[model samples]
Target: MPRDTPYLQVADEIRARVLAGEWAVGDKLPSRARFAEEYGVGQSVAQRAMERLIIEGILEGRAGSGTYVRKARERRRMIRSRIHREGGGSPFRSALKDQGSAGTWECNSRARIPATEDIAARLAIEPGDFCVMTHYEFLADGQPAQLATSWEPMAITGGTDVLLPEMGPRGKIGVVARMRSIGVEISTAIEMPRPARATREQANFLGISVGDLVTQLERIYFDSEGRPVETADIIVPDIRWEIAYEIEVDDSRF
Candidate 1:
């Protein structure tokens, strides 16, 4: 069996203390030098142990202040459903409605941008194909809650009033409605979600620490003809939201 390193040993000891109620939630942890002297380890070792705990969500570091035991996060439920897509309008609007909070958003739309290989694959278009991309920052009750970047093939909306997602007659209406206005009937949407670490930019946008866990969702919408019409990548901070999928069971199964 592999033996525990000095830092791991120190981390385990500290974790035990926390679980034993030696330090309550929001209590400041000992400084690096103090921990080192207590554990008979180097200051670097003690610091590394604390960093591990921070990444594990057991502690948090405040700039210009010391590290403290992290409080339990209050997570709101984020439900994804066809009902929401049809009735709730935007994802941010739906999430806020579920939380009983008001939603506000900022968006920027870029038209006729060339799609990269990955985005082209998702849209089922050739690489370098022109696309309309919109970036969004969403807040609920004045707190940053979600970030999304949506891409649509220009082939579908080119020369249409809905080409720019945030402007024109059907602007800001949403994917299903906007496409319907353009004579396209959206029939299905597919979403895949996975856990990931937040990047520095994402952390800054979501107001969380870098390396904090987040939920990344890849969603694609298709028309009746099975052609990919739109796709988006959404980021939700794990500490702030818990995702729920509302899947309807087919009656024929019974």
Candidate 2:
């Protein structure tokens, strides 16, 4: 039988200790010298073992602070549905309310920005077309929870009271209500979700480590004529929220 490498052996022992509740979450780990002495290995070996656990998310290293066991991640539930749109309330706020947390959001809107190819494709408009772009940062209980960048074609909303998503009479109401006010009756919305690693920008906004797990939802709203009215890319951190879909069953069809 082959023997395990020194670092692997030490790592396994430490993991076992953690699982056995030798140290509670957020407990600072022993110094490298102490671990080396306890494991009968070189200090380098002990360091390697700790580094491996850090990457695995069992531990975290704080600058200017000692290494500590990472706290268990809190998972909040987020439900996506047409009901939320029809309700005319912020979906993030609604989800947080369901979790007993107060949700608030800050938004900034920029108009006359040229749409990128991807945004153009999603909005079904030509590249370089003018669009009103809005960036939103949503917080739950004073903690960053989600980020969203939404775009609407100027051809659809320009010279209207709803040109800016967060201004005017229908401002901050919601996409469905705002579009309806402009004589565009939204009939359908499509969402495509994909798992991805957090970028540095996203990590900064969500107060998480870079490369953390995130879900990117590409959402598009369409009118009765199948014209794309608005599109948004919403970012949800996996450590903070669990994405759920609420689909209605069609008993009539059955």
Candidate 1 regions with alpha-carbon error over 4 angstroms:
1-20, 23-71, 84-87
Q: Looking at model 1, report the run of 10 residues with the lowest lDDT sum.
A: 83-92
What's each prediction's TM-score? 0.75, 0.76
List pairs with backbone clashes in candidate 1: none
The TM-score measured for candidate 1 stands at 0.75
Task: State in Å the error of residue 43, model 2.
Answer: 16
Which residue runs does candidate 2 get wrong by more than 4 Å? 1-20, 25-73, 84-88
72-156: candidate 2 lDDT, tens digit per residue = 5557688887665446366666666776889898999999999999999988889999999999998888988899999999999
TM-score of candidate 2 against the unseen true structure: 0.76
Give a tens-digit lDDT track for model 1, residues 130-239: 99999999888988888999999999999999999888877766788889988999999999999998899998888766677899999999999999999999999998
